[model samples]
Target chain A: MDRNLRAMASAAQERGLALRPHAKTHKCLEIARRQIELGAAGLTVATVSEAEVFADGGFDDLFIAYPIWPSPGRAERLRRLAGQVALRVGIDSVESAEALATAVGPLDVLVEVDSGHHRSGVRPADAAALIEAASKAGHSVRGIFTFPGHSYAPGAPEQAALDEARAMVDAGPHAEVRSGGSTPTARLAGTGPVNEIRPGVYVLNDAQQIELGTCDWADVALTVHATVVSRSGNRAIVDAGSKVLGADRLAWATGFGRLPEFPGARIVAQSEHHATIEFGDEAPPARGDILRVAPNHVCNTVNLADDLIVFSGGEPVDRWRVAARGANT
Target chain B: MDRNLRAMASAAQERGLALRPHAKTHKCLEIARRQIELGAAGLTVATVSEAEVFADGGFDDLFIAYPIWPSPGRAERLRRLAGQVALRVGIDSVESAEALATAVGPLDVLVEVDSGHHRSGVRPADAAALIEAASKAGHSVRGIFTFPGHSYAPGAPEQAALDEARAMVDAGPHAEVRSGGSTPTARLAGTGPVNEIRPGVYVLNDAQQIELGTCDWADVALTVHATVVSRSGNRAIVDAGSKVLGADRLAWATGFGRLPEFPGARIVAQSEHHATIEFGDEAPPARGDILRVAPNHVCNTVNLADDLIVFSGGEPVDRWRVAARGANT
Candidate 1:
């Protein structure tokens, strides 16, 4: 894991925010352990596979922050993990809460409130009804949370945070621990009822972050290493492709990915194993020059690699295994 | 491997077209070995990793169908593999031909001509330039090929194949083996200069094929088995997401994936592991019912799994390891 995690944690402390870094971004045990050592209150996960990884690494506190459906088989796993450490989960609806009531241990449960993203989660007004249902079913309600995913848009973070905080307040005293904000919206949501912040992509900001104006190019901590294989005038081909970087073409994305060093270049197209680049009329990269490509979406990119080559100040340092690279189950 | 692969081969042989099944669709040595036993002429691949898998399994003849740029390291691997088998590769640019000259041994090389896909490959007129470059480098040009990707559109296969055939013929007399056609365009190509066809997805048709009216739902050999985890009056949650089926959203796709058994239900939203579904007043499925989901794209869905469960008449017959599940390199 990157040793600079301590520095990031200290930065979070200065900002007066409790860091519960989302483990779904890296999914490495070493990184999770270090995050805990750096004073992270707990770990946030998107899936059970990620929770399993952190739990096996001996980390205690875990919060799966999705409106997850607790299946019997998976609920058994969660119960086992709950016995080992402090465990919390999220629910968005009365139906999910009712189903989870039978499966989950008497653990801290948060209602996923839809602040802005219009994705999973209930409206703030619906939180009380769901929480009441959970309480009636003998399940403990801990707090309410929302992910301002729409805050990722340029200049939308502040207003999105305000809207989220206001919505959480509208839930009144029932919504005590109002958890809101992602990395992009963290600064805007701090020092409010949304006391806790979960920022997964902050550790390794990506092309999307750059586009969102949340981070500088220098702060990006991860990149896909590719070798130039073919050069045709302004066009060239690199070894990394959709399988490596993922063919996720976001509507406003500048390119498939960005060459961190060669900021002038953009990935024009990608096949499964080869990425095509249009580098204008400049001299194409030599056939063996290894290029560092920063993917547009870091979460999916990390899932593609079996291991990550950790670096500091442009020098290769250590190799961290992506333990749960494709743990879909 | 799929036990019914032999039956699939029999169906193909009845059509008078030899099957050189693309291993890219399902990168498994066990599957490749079975295909060979069932009378597959050779193997087709999109990556060198796939080719290595088949070659290691002792399948001799292999064709890498992508217009890949062979790096020195990859070229060395190709040369080594070439020494062990009859290897043919696709090239679209003069630079790729030069790199191949330096790396590849005496092997058959095909020039990929752009019929209409507009992805990779050169224009029909540019094929001569690439062919001349390859010939000058002592690499014998085998033929010209096109993908006719435009065939995915409704009623466009026949016309796209006609254009593709014209492009191949326009590539001069050196282009002997005019290869074209996928499963959708196989019959529409009309078998002119196209001596061979590579249709890997025919064995397991997907939503894309079904939407294009290429195959019936019964022909789909693969389906994602997901379990319901939560249910309301009409809404339900399942334990499958983008990590399982992939987040490939085609414009013509019918939702993220199709539930063949529960045709009324649709995957409304997906997180990493949780798939939120809206039943909309329909009696919700019981929490344990296994929903068979037909993915929009079978090629990517197979890449996501660690093992493929082969079923004969609905009983689990065998399990084939996805040997090259994350073989991005």
Candidate 2:
């Protein structure tokens, strides 16, 4: 885990870009502290509740990299959180900017642009207009940011990095801190207009990262330990299922998850407490044999567990609490 | 919620079937007590930790309706729990039966037969052999059970019910208490060898149950409250995503979930904290507008939240803790 964190910090340092590792993946205070110690500028979170959790842990600098449309209740909470920490939020629409400004007064904001992911954020060409509107609403418009989510697909990281760089460069001259990059596109984010990169899953790579060629098998730091409960022919049913591994199967995912011990095995189906794995050519493990299974998405898996059992040198070390496990508000 | 619980209890009573409501859905002590008050025979849980949670709540009669393969740690816990409650566990193989019997003394065990769901359980023809092996291992045999999970598909309830009945009958004359039925197949279970039914999602109907024609819209009791954060053209992004409303999307599910307010809208994409809904013909909700969304799977959604806000006559009445939210040992 330390190796993965140090590698990303060194890569960001070499490119003269600020490393603000997204804390949503690990959600552990110890890992976040390690990232900061390795020269991270701040921590990136997905929700206000997550930012508050880190703030409570004595982290002063935090950024919510999400276009938050605060209701009255959330606005009050955000105002309280901003008072405790150096808070920065993302904004993509003028209506949200106005509502935020009216509710929480002046705050640091960044314009989010769509760099081909198309989930959230405005078009790249309209970033300047939103930035101007946000500034007029009594908020500090620092710069622009975009997430290269399209890099998740096979052989798409290079183009996604280029698209992220192009979108930030086109967001006009007022943009000083252009933030972008996911795990797949972090190192590929060239030395251009982008000055900060926020990568969440680099700290603990999962099956998706291994399949995408973003990380090797040795780089993975987390895995679910499951025991084979029942078996028929080549199929082994594990006790760990969607409740532990999570049920976020991307369209391009090979299976629900991957068994690092048996590369030929695929998790064919999963119920609440049972995962049926089909061992194609490998010998199936006997009943009561425990195996390590890597989840397809580490962020969702971490959110499901109350505490993670830390391992070092093939031995149990300690337990780390998922401080922000269900901070979804 | 009371009405839905009562209706299922009444249906099971009229059919002369014992309604052991699966507590994996609600996971709340209050609801489980209510089910017992409404004449439920006992509670069914999916994991050992879940059974431990309910047992700690003073519920003595409990059934772990899963093929549990206990490791040494879990076996020790199960032994302690068995001493406290009238516990009945599901066993599908002679290996698990022998191991369980050796680890945790002689206990009441039920043979699990595959009705149609091939995830776990043995074939009906082989059920007698396993039952004999379990009895030889010094455990008391308590008939058989099968989960009609295949009834989740559209227009599959009738066939799945028949399959369940047939499989239970084929388990031989040693089977006295034949347990079967899911939410979709509960009512369709005819008078046959099956004498008990377990339906979890009937307490809180979800989008899947509504689309499967098993329940009406008014039967749904749980819905996620989210605020519209961003909008563009026909798409509106909400704050509640997979983190709040779990990411369990069945193959036949129409979308991630459904919006009762806007019947024409569909949740197209979801990240950790953002759900992108596409409003087809209905006008998109403005930013900061709160909308209620019904999850595709209520059991998974209930597992995600720490507590649920209860309502009575459209007014917030109380808050109920999800006592077994992460009881996935």
Candidate 3:
């Protein structure tokens, strides 16, 4: 975990980009503190509740990188969060910008420009208008940001980084803090107006990262320690399933998760508490045998766990609470 | 929730089958209490930790329906729980049966037969061998159970129920309390030797249940109240995503989740905190608009939430803690 953190920190520092590691992956106070100690500019969270959790933990600067629509209750929470820390929110629409300003008064905002993920955010041309709208609503438009989530595909990281840079550049003069980059595109984010990168999964690279060629198996720091409960021939059922490893299989994903030790094993079926793994020519695991299973997505997997059992030199070390887990308000 | 509970309770009563609703769905003590009041025989849980949670809540009769391979720590927990409650656990393998008996001492055990799911459980022919092994190890063999998880498909419930009953009947004379049934197959169970139904999701029908023609929209007791965060054309991003609604998309699932208010809309894509919905010929939801979404699978969804906001006639009444939300041991 320290190696991955330092690698990303130095990589960002080398590229002259501010590292605002997304806290949604680890959601651990200790890891966040370590990131800050290693010179992370700030933390990037996904929700108001998450920001509140981190703020309560003494991390001052935080950014909610999603285009959040503040309801009456969330507005009050956002207001309280802004009063405690340097808060930056993502804005992709004029209506939300106006609503947020009205609900919580003027705040630090970033115009979200879509760079081909097409999940959220606005067009590059629409960034200036939304920034103007947010500015008109008495909010300070710090800059623009994009997700580049399309980089999650097998061979799409470099092109996604290019797209992210192009989108930030095309968004015109509002690119002061051109924030972008997920784990896949973070290293390739030096070009164009991009000045900040928020990579969440680099701290705990998972099966997806390894499969995407973004990180190697040695770089993975988090794994679900599962026990083989039942076995028939090469098929074994592990206790850690979607309930622990999470059920976030992408269209291109080979299986629900991957067995790091048994490279030929594939988790073909997963229920809430049982993951049925089809093993290759390797000897099948017997009942009660413990196995380290890598989740497809670290973010979802971490969200499921209450605490991470930190390991050092093949020994159990400490337990880090997933403090902001289930804080998805 | 009351209506759905009453309906399932009465359905089980009519068939002369004990209704042991799986507590893994709600994970709420308040709801579990209500289930007991509605004549549910006992509570069925997925994990030893979950069983312990219910046991701690004062409910005595409990069953861990998975083929659990108890570690030393879990074995101790099981022994403690067995002393506290009328505990019964499932066993599908001779190794696990002997291990469980040796680790926790003689306890009530159920031979798990593979009805049709093929995920866990031994074959019907192998059930007697497991039961004999448990009995020989000085444990009380308490009949058998099967999941019939294949009932989750669109047109497979009836056949799955038949398979469950047939498997139990073929498992020999040890079938005293033949336990089976999921939400889809609960109503269809009654033939052969099946005498108990462990339907988890019947209390809160989700999009999958409705899609499978198992339950109606009115039967859906649980719905995630989310806000529209971003909108572009017909696509609107909601606050609830895979983190809250869960990411269990079966092969035949229509979408990630269903918006009850806008039946035409479909949750096309979901990130950790964002669900992009594509509206079908309906007025696009504006930012900050609250929408109730029924998840693809209620069990996975309930596990993600910290609490369930009880609504009495459209007004928030109480907050029930998800007591065993992450009790996956």
Candidate 4:
């Protein structure tokens, strides 16, 4: 296991907060099993297909943290999942709550609360209405959950977590599992009503984490090992491209991806096969020099690989199959 | 097979042009079989993994049309592919030509001549040098190929095709297969020095094609059938997201994805399970209404799905497994 992940798990344990480590960032059963063994209460999944794979791999307690819509095929799978394990799903509307009642019977669902993501989820004030709807629909509403996605901004996680926790707590008697904290917000998510934290990218921090001053480069356990294929003066091209490190360049992101080993080196452009790098001061790496690239986002990066070769020191110890790698639907 | 695909293939046949369709778009053996039956000359692949999948499925004639850098692993795979089928690879640089000869042995390679994409491939003037390098390395130099990628831009395909044809013809003896056409440029590509045309997206015209005035929405064969999950007054959320339709949204692209069936509806944002939709004078679709979304880029969209539920007029015809769906690296 990566030392950084172990330390993060230790921190969560010390805080008496149950870690429901999100598996979307590293969609490997090995990592999930490790996290569970290290004292994660359950695993957090982004898709029903992911939950299905994890459950098949003996993970009984799982959370499909995303506010997923239940298609007829998907609803059947959810019902199957409910029968197999202690399953918890996310809901944000009365319509969805009604559909869940009709399709999957009585279910334990967390009302998705918006903490500033403005993407999905009901507003903090709207949580009571959803809870009422879930109750009226005869579903077991467990609690409320919100993502501190704005925590990516400077000095936002601590404040966002505080606000998120307050929202969950203020949502009355139904709100119980006050889920909050991303990787960036985990450390700042002080003990409060927040009982569980879903931090996916903490296992393998990215360029965003490094830029946010949340984690050091050494803390990033997983990286795309690429060989230098083109060299031109102080510039060179690495073999890893968008396919290896996903092309998710956020507004605040430094580049397409980051080369943590090579500090200040910028990946200016990415073709399908070549990732052009501009060295700050150090001489360009020779052709065939293996460089470790930390992707801008780990979730999309894991989606790109079929298998992960886990290494302790330089020796390859184990290979983890990305079983849920392409569960897009 | 979709009727539009058959129509497009027939249109090419009428113009006396051979369609060696690019299979990187769908990456399905079933789709390739349909294309071949519809009068396609052979198959074109973007990566070695794609070629391997197609070849293993009894595709005898394969063209790896990308300007691939022959790394040891890729070269070894290519050598195996050469032994299995009638293989023709693409080369843009003299170094790559030399490397291909050493690794893949003597090979029939297409000298990649630049059109307007400016991504991979050598300039037309540089084509002779690359071909000479291949000949010197004791490799069978086939011809030259160019992609009119910039043809996706407004009114560029016609001029781009002319430029590409001139470049190929300028190479003189080295230019045997002056390939110059994408879906957008296929109509402009005439029978001159250009012996073959590689147009992949024409098989499944996308939102990009429709916006580029290359094809009508009705001509688009492949559409992601998504159901509305969440609805507000102004914006609604659908099940199709980046994971399904892909996140390759160009700056000029009108929407994240297009709704061919629901005219004037556009996808504004895409999360993993939610696609935020913004309607333009179009009646808002009710929750559970299956919207047929035409992805902006069909190649990457197909790469996301495990299998394509091929539909012939609202009924499931066949389930085509995307053999090379997640074959990244």
> Each candidate's TM vs. the true structure?
0.90, 0.99, 0.99, 0.92
Q: Which residue window of length 10 is worst by lDDT in model 3 chain B?
A: B168-177
Residue by residue across B1-329, what tens digits does model 4's lDDT show?
36756875876787777788888787888888989888888888877888899999999999888656677788788889999999998877777778778777898888887676665667777778878888999888878888867676777778888877787687644466666678877777777767788888887778888888888877888888888776766677887776677666666778787887666777877665678888876557777678888888887778777888877767897888988876655
What tens-digit string does per-residue lDDT give for candidate 2 at A1-329?
88999999999999999999999999989999999999999999999989989999989999999999878888999999889999999999999899999998888998899999988899989998899899999999888889989899889999999999888888754588899989999999878778999999999999999889999889989999999999999999999888899898888888899988788899989888999999997778999999999999999999999998989999999999999999988
lDDT by residue for model 4 (A32-70), tens: 888988899999988889999999989999998877678
lDDT of each: 0.76, 0.91, 0.91, 0.79
Lowest lDDT sum, 10 consecutive residues, model 4 chain A, at A167-176
Deviation in Å, model 2, residue A209 alpha carbon: 1.1
Worst 10 residues of 3 chain A by lDDT: A168-177
User: Cα lDDT of model 3 overall?
Assistant: 0.91
Which residue pairs clash within candidate 1?
none
TM-score of 2: 0.99
Residues B252-322, candidate 1: write the lDDT tens digits.
66567777776667777665565667765678687667788887778777887789988877799888898
Residue B187 local lDDT, model 1: 60
Question: Per-residue lDDT tens digits of candidate 3, residues B266-309?
Answer: 98899999889999787688888889999999999999988888
Every model's DockQ, to 2 decimals?
0.37, 0.86, 0.87, 0.34
Candidates ranked, most accurate by TM-score first? 2, 3, 4, 1
Quote the lDDT for A188 in model 1: 65
Q: In angstroms, how far off is B316's CA in candidate 1?
A: 2.9
Off by over 4 Å in 2: none
Which candidate, 1 or 2, has the higher TM-score?
2
* Lowest summed lDDT window (length 10), candidate 1 chain B: B1-10
Q: Which stretches of candidate 3 lie over 4 Å from their true place?
A: none
Q: For all candidates, what are the clash counts? A: 0, 0, 0, 0
